[model samples]
Structure formats: C-alpha cells, structure tokens
Target: MVNRVEITEAAAAVVARLEAQHGPLMFHQSGGCCDGSAPMCYPAGDFRVGPQDVPLGEIAGCRFYIGAAQFDYWRHTQLIIDVVPGRGSGFSLEAPEGVRFLTRSRVFTDDEVTELAARGEPERAG
Candidate 1:
C-alpha cells in the first residue's frame, strides 16, 4: 500500500544515529504556532498520543502522528520527512544533532485520494 508518510535517506541516517543514542523513537508533526510546525522527534512514549492525534504512518522505524485538526487540513497530501542543516525545536530529540526534521508535502492525486478515502485514517498507534 502507498504510505501517507515517508523519510528520505538522509533523515533515515539521522534516525539511526538518534536511535543509537536514545533507542526506539516517535514523531509528532507540530500543531503549529509556537513550535513552528516542525516535525518533532522524540523517544517512544515521551510524547503522548491521544484522541486529538491521528497516526499517519511510520518512517525510519518510528511511528508518526499529526494532530486531528492538522490531519483534516492535510488529508489530501503525503508527508515527506527530511533533514536539513540547523537546530529544530528545543524539545525535539534531533535539535541537539544540528539538524531538524523537516516536513515536505504533496497533494494526493484523485486516484490516490480515492484509495486513501477507502482505507480511512490509519489506526492510531498504541
């Protein structure tokens, strides 16, 4: 099945380095505003996944989530997780690594949207 989220090779390498330092991880797409909407990486269970969030998919062996409201806005697109030079949010694990987890997106085509609509939102990760 086509995934709604994916990670670039560079980001995967970063994930590897992070996992070596911190173990299994997770990601939360910022809810915008103060955090500036950067995707934040955290050690698994560090960030709580509640009803307000929806699981998009996994990337670099990590679970990913988007706020329900943000998911409503982005349901038509696919998210591409990447790494860029620079520090990210202070709370994100990658911040100390001198790189940030960036989110790039593309709108889904009609057919892809139809398929996704049929599948519905993925079940939230436990």
Candidate 2:
C-alpha cells in the first residue's frame, strides 16, 4: 500500500531525539495560515485528535494527521515530513530544538491513486 505520509532520514533522527525526551509523539497538520500550515508535533495525546482529522499513517513511530479540510486538498499527494534548521512554531514541541518540522509533498501517480482508492478511505480520528 502507498503511504499517505513518510519522513526523511533527518526528520526521523529528529523524531528519535524528541521521542527520547517526550516519550511518544504525534503530528497534526491544520489548514490555517502560516505556522498553522506547518505540521505541529506534540507529545502524544497532548494534542487531541478530533473526529474530523484524517490519519495519514505513521512516520518515525508517530501518527500523522491532517484536518479534514486539509485532507480534501491534499488527498492526491503524498506528504513528506522533513526537518530544517530554524525555529518552528512555538506551539510545536520541536521549536525548542531550533529545528522545525516541514511538510513537502508530491502528487501521486495514477496507479498509486487507484491503489489508494481501492484500499478505501483512511480511518478518521475519533
């Protein structure tokens, strides 16, 4: 199956570091502007996942999610989670590490899209 999201090695390393400090972690991508658009990392369960959120599979042992509206806009693409050297939103746990999580994406090919469709809609957050 094609994963809706994946993480780069650098991002995975960062996640490992964060996990060592925070225990478990999760990510939420909102449809708001600016920092809200950036994937927000939190200590798992710190940020509540609402019923409207779409679970986009896991990256580096962390569950990734996107708001329903955001999922509608990005359903055809694969989200790539990356880490860059810079201060991210203060709201995200990584902001203290001087590196922020970023969302990079690529549109799925026809075959991948078809495969995803056949697999059925992803489960939504409850």
Candidate 3:
C-alpha cells in the first residue's frame, strides 16, 4: 500500500517561493552514509522517482517524493523536514542531525510509512 506524505509550514513556504520564481517544487532522496539517505530539492522535471517513493503530500502545488531506502531508515526516526532558502529561489530541506540525505529519490511504499509510523515518530503536517 502507499500513503500520502505531509509537509510543514517552512517547507510549504519554500515550495511557494520556488513555484513563484521557478515553476514547481521537487524533492528527492538517495543513498548516503550515516542514515543512508539524504533530501534534495530540484527544478521541475529534474528528478525521477525510484522504488522507494513516498508521497510526502504537497508543498505549494507540487508533490514531494522521498526514496524507499531513505524512508526505511527514517521510518521510526523523529525526522523533521524544514525548507531553508538559499540565494535567489534556491531552497533545501533541514533534516535533524544524524540524518543523511540521499540527494535523489526512490519513493516510499505504504508498508514503509506504516512501519515507520509504528516506530513512534509523529509525522508533522504543518
């Protein structure tokens, strides 16, 4: 099964800004060290959803995707995502320490979300 992911206020603001300047907002997760996953924001049509795709709801009017591999590691982790602005319309996520981003996306499965939820970290929908 698959479930929709949620975004936060800071993330929403970042998405809005990106859309205002660029067009749409895109997020990805890829393999990495430590937690083995990292988050990345991309220009529209710049990313591909891998097997670990998780629907992290929408920011502004765009969908956010996280790879399954990253989700697996963060399933039960107290993961928080924040959108930080760079120069111009550039923005990225501010994940808690100990969390590594994938720099690509793999999408998340429903089972993964459920399992991660079961581990006890509340998903923030702001």
| Candidate number achieving the greatest TM-score relative to the actual structure | 2
**Candidate 1: where is the Cα deviation over 4 Å?**
124-126
Tens digits of per-residue lDDT, candidate 3, 1-126, equal 233344567666655665676676676554555333445666667676654476555545666666665556655433344544332212343232222222222345667757755655434322
Residue 10 in candidate 1, Cα distance off native in Å: 0.5
Q: Give all TM-scores, in the order shown.
A: 0.93, 0.97, 0.51
- Residue 115 accuracy (lDDT) in model 1: 89
| lDDT tens digits by residue: candidate 2, 46-89 | 99999999999999999999999999999999999999999966
- The numbered model that scores best in lDDT is 2
| lDDT agreement of model 3 with the native | 0.51
Off by over 4 Å in 3: 1-4, 34-37, 77-79, 84-126
**What C-alpha lDDT values do all the predictions have?**
0.88, 0.93, 0.51
Residue lDDT tens for model 1, 22-103: 9999999857875568898989999998878889888989999998878888878999999999886669988888999889
Output the lDDT of residue 63, model 2.
92
The predictions' CA RMSDs to the true structure, in order, are 1.5, 0.8, 9.4
